[model samples]
Target chain A: MLSEPLIERLTETPLFAVGLTLAAYLLGMALFRRLKQPPWLPGILMAALLLAGFLAISGIHYTAYQDGAAWLSVLLGPATVALGMPLYQQLPRIRELWRPLAICLPISASLAAFYAVGIAKLMGASDHVMASLAAKSVTAPIAIGITEQLGGSVALLMGALLITGVAAIAFVSLVARVMKIRDERLIGFALGLNGHALGTVRAFEIGPTAGAFASLGMSLTGIFTALLLPLAWRLLGG
Target chain B: MAALSGFLWLISFWLIGEVVVYFTVLPVSSGVIGMLLLCITLALRGGVPESVACAAQPLIALLAMLIMPGVVGVFFIAGELVGQWTAILVGLVLGTLLSVVTTLWLMQRLMRGHHAE
Candidate 1:
């Protein structure tokens, strides 16, 4: 039902792929806001599904989509750096809470990695699968590098990372409520420590202070886990 | 122009971070290093620059969208995912929950200690 020129333009041009991503995300944002921002329907997940569905229906490869979307991906680095603004705004509190935060972040990050690999091993997963799962809680950029160093499949690591992020966003509120967690800082730190970037999104929704702490947790987790995972792997003789 | 300037500054910080990581033995990513550098700068300056805040606001606003491309990469390996679905799912859920609970408990314990002091 499509014209030859239109199909050609879509497949051959970069604009179509880039536009597709933005359009999908915009629609996801609209729906998310309209629906009162449910945790399960986080904008990124919905947008990814929409984009993935579009690619599936059109028979286009993800690599083709990446051709146009790569520009947006490049910004992830700067956006990450930009997180310093809010964190700087809340630096005093972060300083005051540094003792607890510094102590808790590395422990939780290692625990997340250890528990993930442990469960994977119990479930009879191969070493590569275990390695991929070990870095599930860190942000994608750092995670990909860690996975490479640990000799895991990059595709599997990417999938597991998103899965952990979505799960963290969806279940965090319930977990906090059940645990009787009321302090926003603690809640944010927990989310960021476990969830990474997606968790930071949820923390922002809770409050600015929470968002700041979440950013702190995310950064610290990335730093600690990246340094420690390889050392831990060597210690385990992997 | 302020937003543009802020954007450039953030990118420069990122570049600095990349250079630092390239030279150093630290395992942290350049983006995070940039964030730390900027945080220290802001703290020393007594506040964040208006320009940086302006640029950072919109980027943070759509932070989810920025990461979507990587997430969409998931579609490419659907076969592997289906095969490993059970183990991956169980591991993710357990790992995330355990991390959350332990961090919360330890944080509270530490905070209580500080209060007692």
Candidate 2:
């Protein structure tokens, strides 16, 4: 129903990138529904892949896409703040579990960064690579900011984040089988701590209790990492 | 309308976090600080506002989608990923293994020791 010039002008604005992203997401969701929504196969990742392919084929630049896409990315802040709701809802369990969680949280959260950065360093990567790797275990919204402050490439961190999240599906189940740890709380906590948002989604699929715990785990771990990683980076001179 | 107010509350906390960071120069995400402040506030309130509950449900549910645009940025810098693929794979695999395993094991040991649920 639009004229050719109008269409071209709209394509040059933020609408083009936003519409493309939405379309890709919808398609990814459709495909994900078809596949029964496996933990390893998240719709976001699928949409990202499709969007990338579309950009490449159409000869569109990432910069062009980013100009508009930043608007959507900004919503991540509000979403992060929204996490407070679930954490609030889980108040009863948190009070009950606070003692043990107090002991367990700091250690697990630290190792989440330690392992990623430690291994990436062992692999002979650059300092920026290590910095990017450091925050991969955290959720995207917080992780992006951490990575930026560490002078790492956001794009590279996304790749590492995806790998880490997808690996979490197998990791939790593997823990269950090999470690004989089947308590949904521990399982979901492990999943969210190690996997971030993707793991939280998988946790929700497991049950309401697991979902709440996963939310708790993800939020606390995010806060923990955000509070400390920069200090650690300063101390270690990363 | 309730959902809209909930969103407003979230942004207010987020802005407070940003202001705190601006003054303190904390090298962390304002969103995270915002989340922390929101938690503290909710703890004081003794419950989540219904508006917040409603707004948070859908936002958290669609978090993956909200995060998509940023992840898609990877395509722009795919070049940087060229030589580092091995590091990424090994890092994710072993790192996640160690992380998940140690968390479960330690939490188990602690919880079992105290008989805490």
Candidate 3:
């Protein structure tokens, strides 16, 4: 139970938390660049972790920062809408590969969800946690919704997504090498489908075409996973 | 005009998302659905509004930033998360590896036929 004054203080100025997060992200980006590691490694995850540490050290509760940080969350809607432009620009190529794009997008999304749930269950995760885990590959908001629908915790779903993005960034290139998968577009698409925004950013760095495909993959995965997870859940009796 | 166009584009994208989700039964966001919808529309319509494109660009640039807020929620629940960290970590790593491999394999098969075509 929190005191009234503490609750008010917690909710009062979320901007500070937002600012702290941005600063941490920028610092992490600079450090990752200086170290010549992958940019996504530090960008979001490091920022989140460092901020968490700082708040913990300062004895500021998580609720206090969230009050200020919710503003950043609101931007996700518009940012998602904004992805339309590059997708629009990539229309010609998309048309050229429409059949492949259409077929691969759903199949890849289904496999990603299935593998996540199956493996988690095998490892002995409970049904609800597995439901949240199933949406790990998609973007955050949609994944959160899917988590709720499947009777899982939204916070758990978010945590799972952040970790998934970080891991994809760290190992996707390695996996590509192992599989001998070479096409830039395919690599980008794979990363995006599995990694979400972090993978899409990596794809952009690889090349414009790769970025475009990755964006396409990310968007398609979000849609596909959201639509299919419930049906898959029922079939799995989850 | 920018606001109006942004709103219209948002609606268009949302409709596109709903239609795609409805037809394909894929659970995607309205924005991504909107992006795919816009892609097809541009292909058929053969162009896009310069203003619409212009308006959408900055928004995209701020995407990573946009997601920060939702992620910040983690800070609030850090204690609880720390307790269940192992399951979360395992789920993320294994899920990502599986998805990436699956996506790569599926795309490879899909693209194999494309090269043949």
Clashes of each: 0, 0, 9
* Cα lDDT of model 1 by residue, A55-153, tens digit: 878777778788778888788788878877877876677779778877877778889898889887888777878887888988766676577678877
- Best-to-worst DockQ order: 2, 1, 3
Name model 1 segments beyond 4 Å from true.
A1-8, A141-145, A148-155, A234-238
Higher-scoring candidate on TM-score, 1 or 2: 2
* lDDT by residue for model 1 (B1-117), tens: 999999999999999988998898565568778877888899889987789998988987766777777778777776765666788789888777777778888888888897897
Question: What TM-score does prediction 2 earn?
Answer: 0.94
| Candidates in descending TM-score order | 2, 1, 3
Write model 2 residue lDDT over A61-159, tens digit each, in one string. Answer: 678778888777788888888877777777788788898899899999999899978888889878978888898889888888888889988888887
Q: How many Å off is the CA of B27 in candidate 3?
A: 7.5
Return whichever of 2 and 3 wins on DockQ: 2
The stretch of ten residues in a row with the least summed lDDT in candidate 2 chain A is A1-10
The Cα error of candidate 3 at residue A127, in Å, is: 2.6
CAPRI grade of model 3: acceptable
| DockQ pick, better of 1 and 2 | 2
